[model samples]
Target: MTTLDSGERRRGSDTRPLITELIDEGTVESIAQEAWISLVGEDEVLVPLPGGPATDPVSSWVDVVGPWTGSVVLTTGRRTAEELTRALLREHSPAVLEEEDVADAFGEIANVVGGNVKAALPGPSGLSLPDVGSAPALRNPADLCRVELQWRGEPVSISVQGALPPLPAPR
Candidate 1:
């Protein structure tokens, strides 16, 4: 009879790499910039300066499951989200934006950004459907790679954070 390890032998040790180890802030910023230009519009640029805290904040995110599992979250104020929706929709935007409109548009943006982020990571990953609401609580701070930027003068932040807490130190 042949016996398989079943990954039990390494259970006490976690060799998984952190987000910081896999991707950097500048790469994330560049990804966002590309997504912005492609989806938001060529004229729309994400300035790499912090625009301060957001009021009436909302967040959209998608989960990535693979060697490094986590969420790619995009957060900004509700008003800014609406503006983003309009920018995304352009002339197709409704005269009065609805909650569903915001959710769909914002979720799509998260999808695009999340997709690009996933591609940059080590592959064989799966992405979850985008969700819009409050951002997920940070689990392992050391596994986070975040970037803050201004879009149309509003504060927007992108956080690529790991979903798991720090593993117990190897004995």
Candidate 2:
């Protein structure tokens, strides 16, 4: 954020609450579970156990702008993403899934999860359209709320991270 005074731009102090203060790992896990059940299938479950790290990660995210600003990101393996698309699409899934198909389905899941996350946050906040690609880099570790889980034994991670870097230490 920027402060304007006397024709000069000054950096504003970041007083926003850290994501960890506003939310927690359990909350993020619960949110993801609910989204999975509703969108993936009523019986679909997200186990709290952490699986091995993703080999080829693909991420989908929606930017949240408000009293706390950042992106709600979902990251998993490309193969897992394809499997999720097939599961989400079910009978309607193509015999051969296209790249766009995976992106669309994966992005939709992020949208649902991100929307709920935005609502849980101090609002009057705006949610951006879901984007599929690499995950956003962490700006401040202290400002992150992250959860790791398994979906069909595949590793999946959800991160609610701050957009801005940490504030300078008071001198």
Best by lDDT: 1
Cα lDDT tens digits, model 1, 78-114, are: 9999999999999999999999999999999999999
Clashing residue pairs found in predicted model 1: none
Segments of candidate 2 deviating more than 4 angstroms: 1-14
Task: Report the error of model 1 at residue 125, Å.
Answer: 0.6
Consecutive 10-residue window with the lowest summed lDDT within model 1: 6-15
Clashes (N, CA, C under 3 Å) per candidate: 0, 0
- Cα distance off (Å), candidate 2, residue 121: 0.6
What is the Å distance of residue 77 in model 1 from its true position? 0.4
Candidate 2's TM-score: 0.91
Q: Mind giving the per-residue lDDT tens digits that candidate 2 earns over 16-109?
A: 6889878878888898999999889999999998887898999999999999999999999999999999999999999999999999999999
Clashes of 1: 0
Give the C-alpha lDDT of model 1.
0.95
Model 2 lDDT, full chain set: 0.91
Candidates in order, TM-scores: namely 0.91, 0.91
